[model samples]
Target: MKLRRDGESVYVRPMKLDDAEALYEMRTRNQDFFQTYEPIRQKLVMTLEDYRDRISDDIQHWRDQTGFTFGVFLQETNEFVGRVSLSNIVYGAWKNCTIGYFMDQAHNGKGYTTEAVSLAVDFALTDGQLHRVQAAVMPWNQASVRVVEKVGFRFEGLSKWYLQINGNWEDHNIYAITQEDWNK
Candidate 1:
């Protein structure tokens, strides 16, 4: 619900409209990092007005209980280095949500993403009172695969056409950790 800061390296906080410029900047700079795995949206090429509209929409989604998106900040430089989120939350018998994230290319190998993801997962499983948190990683993304594994998610095999990544159905290996599983 609030943006949280962890020393001079990592910070996790709810996304804000004030974050639009930095977010857009990050996306623009890391175009290649996202182009292959994300939806093909020219939205990143938007002007300030377009960014405002999109940020408004992002805020509304979280307000409406659709999803929770957090900006990952590099506290030393106070830059938005990436984003981490819990989306597609389901209630009732399936109290779960999916974990997703990305880091700035310059910050890729420093273990910041993994550290941020670990914090997010802990928040989801503990503070958020969620039953399970899951992630679907492309098998080729060894770094991402390792991040989830390190955070306690167990490999659950591959799912064909699991997600519509990059505008086409893509196979993704499923990884998940239930609250009980985490406790174990």
Candidate 2:
């Protein structure tokens, strides 16, 4: 299932194996910059094959309804710009999902992430039919905070030591948008 949605400057779609090369390049180029915000997963540079394998798992996650990750690409140039995901989807009584994303450092402040977040939230609330979508950002990540805010996610509260990033527990400002909020 290759699902895609187009924005003026970019498109969001389920990443395919053939996209591995560009994805690998983007991740590698932004490796240092991304590490500051992301969790410490590994020390070695990930191989192209690793990205392919990861995409395979991500595709499975989509099919299983547990998560969905989309590659954000520059529409005009057809270049990889970033990745966004609605992960940890919960059904039944608690219909919700967690949204996460990262962009190549070179693409920062270009409205790509804001557009991607909007697309992801729209998909979760409208297409996926989830009740709520949430994003947690380190208090210092003002850029990310702005992204979610621009997408209409209201600040819910703060959680102390919510998640460990770079080996240390960090506080996160939680933000969310519910189905009702989306209807507005």
Candidate 3:
């Protein structure tokens, strides 16, 4: 589903193919920064076509009820500065999802991500759609740990080899926020 999200200083919405150019520009500009945590996709340096193809798949995932992703844009310029998502959805009594996100390096530390995450979490729990949303942050990623914490995800202890990051086993601290926690 296409979601509309807004906060005091920013706007966020479901991503679209037309966003390829702006998204690519931001990724290219922050190549070195993102490379630290994410495996560098060679196609990122090629053309907007690659971005379009990937985002197209994500958009379809939304339609197919497989996942949800949103692009965070600056209100003043409508520039795509980041993305936040909830994937790995599970139905039944669980009704949970996994959350992940990142902001453009230049936009870091401006509280954009914190606010964006709050909005996304609110949307997730507002209608009782998800019972819980979880995140796994690498210990070294202090910034991400802070973001998830700011959005009410509490530390849930360490998970050895928690994620496959940069194509390797990586340790992480699992964090989670449930509808009950969010309400409180």
Candidate 4:
């Protein structure tokens, strides 16, 4: 699956096999910063080969229609700066998925994540033929909260101890946008 979506300053597409190195580098560089917001990983990348295998899984997931992972790139340099994903997809009676993303610390406060998410939500509700997309952000992550809000996701509620972040279970503010919400 070839998914390419562009924003004013950034573009998003799947990470290719050849991009494994870049992916590893970005993850390694941002591991410490990302840890504050993400679940603590035992290791960022055990080895480049293992990282490549994970990249392959991402591709396969996109192909299989189970999940979609996209690398955020700078339009000017085409530099890999971040990643976004629409995963936990569901169909039939309830067509929905959850959105996830992270940006390189260097690129923070640039609106890159907001634009990337907007484009991703477009794909989720339009191209992906899904009805709803949701995001769970830690209460402390105001940056991410703003990103989803900028993309028009409304606050749904709070999920107590929703996910374990950096080892301890953390409360999250749930936000969501349905197809109807997106159309508005």
Error of 3 at 154 (Å): 1.1
The local distance difference test score of each candidate is 0.82, 0.91, 0.85, 0.89
Better of 2 and 3 by TM-score: 2
Residue 20 C-alpha lDDT in model 3: 86
Q: Tens digits of per-residue lDDT for model 1 on 1-184?
A: 4346463478888778898888878777888878887877755476666766766876786777667777898777778898898889886788899999999998998888888887788777776678999899999889998899888899989999987878888899999999998777
**Candidate 3, overall lDDT?**
0.85
Each candidate: RMSD: 2.1, 1.3, 1.9, 1.4
Task: Spell out the clash pairs found in candidate 4.
Answer: none
TM-score of 4: 0.96
> Against the true structure, what is each candidate's TM-score?
0.89, 0.96, 0.92, 0.96
Candidate 2 stretches with Cα past 4 Å from truth are none
Which residue pairs does candidate 3 place in steric collision? Answer: none
Per-residue lDDT of candidate 4, residues 1-184 (tens digit): 2269988999998879988888888888887898898887786556778779988998998888889888899999999998899999998888889999999999999999999999888888888889999899998888999999999999999999999998999999999999999897
- The alpha-carbon lDDT assigned to residue 11 of candidate 1 equals 80
How well is each residue in 1-184 modelled by candidate 2, as lDDT tens digits? 2268889998898889999999898898888898889789864678999999999999999889899899999999989899999999999988999999999999999999999888888888877879999999999999999999999999999999999997889999999999999898
Q: Which stretches of candidate 1 lie above 4 Å from their native place? A: 1-8, 42-44
lDDT of 3 by residue, 1-184 (tens): 3278789877778899999898889888888888778754655565778889979998998877678888999888988899988899887889898988889999999999998888788777764288899898899999999999888898999999976777787999999999899988
